[model samples]
Target chain A: MIDLSTFLKEMISLPGLSGYESPVREPIARTWQPLVDELSVSKLGSLHGLRRANVKGDHHSVLIATHMDAIGLMVAGLDDGLLRVMSIGGLDLRILVGQMVTVHGKRELPGILQMIPDRLQDKSKAGSPPGITDLFIDTGLPINEVSDLVKLGDLVSFATPPQEMSGGALAGHSLDNRASVAALTLCLEEIRKFNLAWDVWAVATTQEEETLVGARTSAYEIKPDIAVVVDVTFAKGPGVTDYHTFAAGKGPTIGVGSNMHPALGKYFKTLADEMDLPYAMEYMPKSSGTDAMAIQVSEEGIPCAVLGIPLRYMHTPLEMVVLKDIQRTGRLLARFITQLETDTMEKIFGERKA
Target chain B: MKELIQKLCEISGPSGYENNIREAIKKEVTPYADSIEVDPLGNLMVRKGKKTEGGLRILISAHMDEIGVIVTHVEKTGFVRFGNLGAAFPWYLPASRVLFLNGTRGVINSEPREDNTKVSTIDQSYIDVGASSPEDCPVKIGDVGVFERPFMDMGTRVASKAMDNRSSCAVLIETLRQLKKSPHELVFLFSVQEEVGIRGAVTASYAIDPDLGIAVDVTSVGDTPSAKQMEVGLGKGAAIKIRDSGMLCDPRVVRWMRETAEKASIPHQMEILRQGSTDAYVIQTSRSGVPTGAISIPCRYVHSPSEVVDVKDLESSVQLLLKLIGGPVQLK
Candidate 1:
């Protein structure tokens, strides 16, 4: 049996941010190379792994996608040894100040995002954080030495490592997505033994944090019959109400609504119930702003579904995830792939589906 | 080009109701069309390219609809209330001239307020359509009204109502009119209800699943005062859209259009609109597969009754489309 937690830890330790994803991409390709029947990648850096079945045309060609990119910052400008930074993705300015980060400049250097204090009185003003212009990174070196190591547009990432807490929870950066990639890798490990009859595609998508470009290009290139996206959803936490967030410590979330195919969503729910696995029915009510959004509209619409692992502090440096929830998501996806068939695909959607 | 665009901007077509502009486009396209068809949803499909061998189904789309208001109720004293169709900023609607779909002109009046008084809203404002009383009203509930149509020539810049997209539709018609023999079978689709929610392209894409699609729309220009600092601007020529907030356009199609413009030496610029969307959202992922891109006429004050654009840009768009279609079918 593969240790899924170990794989997730390895993935979360690396910092492959929005545009600079080659670090995570190379290691992921190495792990997925031997698991699929065919390997193809998009110019935008989407890695797809396929495994065809022993029986001919018995399985419906299906694509399971998980994005591997994380959100970070770039050195917009430099002042003294402290570099002024701009976030590449959405950043909650409240937690950004005083956070330690790894500066991927000409060479890797350690830095910290800090702010200058003004003698303003109101706490309201303090609570309302300043723009990127107000944030800067302190590189312990002198101005001349720092200038030699760091240049403009150099990527900077949070310096938190994957830490396992006592309550089956793992904390680190990029768990919003990298953990999903780890779950995908575990699914590939189980799928090698199953003699299912269908073309199974496992894609480690890129740049999902910034835009839907990777999924957009990959969906066009592969043009699969059905698509299932795996990503993270915000979980219940302190000061959190039901309106803004869902319950944490729950199992994976099964999305149902207009954009997601209703049948495919119901299929996953039924499968989870039959297996007695923990799951929840969440309604996106519209096109989900994940990889599923790009996949559903590709090539006359694909019957797509999203399975989410409950995560905490999404889009932050130290996001939280349950270790067992990862295993559950892996097993459920592997089961879906092993059971994929052409008749099932046609039945879920009308015969118009290719 | 300036005169033609001026004529097009003077027309009006709001979402879910575009008959007046539909009939006007029919007149323009009828002369050049071997056949033309208008669906029940009010989308006009004009077919040209009198060739038989290409087997190509290419859709050239430009939305005919613009932002406007729908009369929700009529209060006493002939004060008509309304709701906006698209992103008409609440602050930009106080004193603008509005016209009903049936050619009834009115003024959007905000009630006078003291410094201590609250500002009025869409629900509070009234359309003075010169009606004597509620019983004498010609424009009632459910009637659509827009900024009164006007085409003004300010030196080289032309400003008119519904130019957000009507400029593109006119260019499509002009391109079809100027074609000798298009190698690819062209479907000049005057899509409807784009401002509401891209309602027409959703069905049109199903009807004509093309090998390739090009959405002719308007992209934001950075040269405007206090505008977001993007590179593309008015009078620079055709603007090739790379990506917008709503869609990630095909990279191959983006490269193809850029190269086409460069090869023909047509002055053009690249656009990355941080906000809003275009018909390209449906064109890229419509049927089976379609490589999609957009050529925009850089226009200012979009969504307002009077959107200002350059006639030079319109001519540049026509030349670029002509070179792309009739010249040589090149694929990257």
Candidate 2:
């Protein structure tokens, strides 16, 4: 089996911004190749790995979609020896100052996201945090060399390497979703030991950060009987202990909301309880802000459930997650799939009807 | 039609918690619909006409959700701190009444501030549900509620909370009730969660994959005192939307709606709303892409407790929709 921490570290190291996911897709496909029966890429660039059912006589399938895309910056314009950038996803501008980044130009060059000094900034804006237009990616090259190597529309990703923290936690950029991808990968690996009765599609979706295009198209194509969208949720951390945030290093969260199918959410909660797994019931009263949002409404609508791994400092380069949460999420998914019979739909719908 | 609009407007269905309104709408459309089903996202889809060879699939959508609030925290004193479910403005919340889905009522008020200070944000306000202590509180986290206001009839106009959308729902329902026959297949969709992000229509359109789509909703009017400049106003007939912030109506669909209204001699006006959008925004981009437009009822004070729409506009909207969907919809 592949190591979860190492796989996640490798994923976060790559540059796979929304709509540009080939770099991360390669490693995911390589890892999932030997674990499933078939592997294919959707036209919209989502990685789909199908682990066929061991039981015969036409069974249902479940799509486990985890977005592999990461939030990053793109070169929107070129300044004198510096690059003007625009964010590809939701980024907190306050956290971008002094952050290390890799400018994916003609050659991979290291850069730093730097804000203009207060002395040189507009008088009224001096005390305020700089906006995207006020920031620049400064590579240590001359203007001629910088212009030669970098072009407009080049992608820039966080260069922060994954760091192991106290209590078996890991920190890095793109862990918002890469952690979920590692969990789904762990589920795929663990399910190999079970004689599964339903086909399991482990899909590494793209463009979840910007558009849900990847999950939307993949769900329409796969049309799974049920979809389990695994993604990261906010972990309770410094000054951020709110109702929406869960604790890290505990267990995964089973989402309960409009985006989630109530019966499927209950099934996961029941399974977690039976297995003595610690979990939280996260309430996402509106949109779950996951692939489940799109998948739930795809092509006549598929019953959807969302599993969340709590990570701190979400969408930042130093986002952190406890490794145990990933493992627990993976274990829960494996157990659920292994326990799914051919009549699991009936059981779920029965619960719904009741 | 007025009674149906009043009934729908009074129901307590926020963006995500739309079960009550969905049930209410199902009861209204069941007798007229050939097949009625609710999608996973709580969108009520009713199939009225059958599909024939080469017949166009037309999806007529009216969102059932209204902008409201979700309880995020219950204070120690039993006051509820909440978040906006859609676009619940903090300015509109002060001194307003809210009713939770569980039948708990509360009055929204801001913390005491010196005179001339303003409550410009939601965090500065809380809902007093009359629970003196946390233990006595009836509303908990994740509970949703909408503005509690009675629907009012003002001769040619109606005023109520959720009139922004329930008025449109009434129009769609009336269109379904009065239409005798049509060559094209019609799917009347009462979508959920449109105020949040036009979410319900995205999936419903993909499922229906209609050749043409039209959304009937309320649009802001400029006739209000010092309102934002717009070409739409109450009592001006059905507003054939040309563009909004989210989507520009397809020329073909726009032309079809305008031409149909002209031929039927239905009162109509061209609308160019600079702010806000409708379900047609997402429906136009569903799947391989659908040519979509919106028929907006001119509304005053939208997203407030007292949204007013002229009854003449609602009737005209229903008539226009009937004429558009009444025959074979040829886009060419």
Best-performing candidate as measured by lDDT: 2
TM-score of each: 0.76, 0.56
lDDT by residue for model 1 (A103-175), tens: 9977899898988764553465565676766788998999999889986556789999889988889999999
Against the true structure, candidate 2 reaches a TM-score of 0.56
C-alpha local distance difference test of each model: 0.80, 0.87
For model 1, the stretches where C-alpha displacement exceeds 4 angstroms are A1-33, A38-50, A53-127, A130-174, A197-228, A235-238, A241-306, A317-325, A336-354, B30-35, B48-57, B114-119, B177-183, B228-230, B326-332
Question: Per-residue lDDT tens digits of candidate 1, residues B139-215?
Answer: 99999977875688886678887788888987898898888877678888999999888888868876877777889
Please write out the lDDT profile of model 2 over residues B203-229, one tens digit for every residue. Answer: 899889888889999988877786654
Q: Provide per-model DockQ scores.
A: 0.07, 0.03
TM-score of chain B of each: 0.93, 0.97
Q: If you score just chain A, what TM-score does every candidate get?
A: 0.94, 0.97
List iRMS for all predictions.
6.2, 9.8
lDDT of 2 by residue, A209-277 (tens): 866767887888898999999999999977865787999988999999999999999999999999999
How high is the lDDT of residue A160 in model 2? 95
Give the poorly placed runs of model 2, Cα more than 4 Å off: A351-354, B1-332
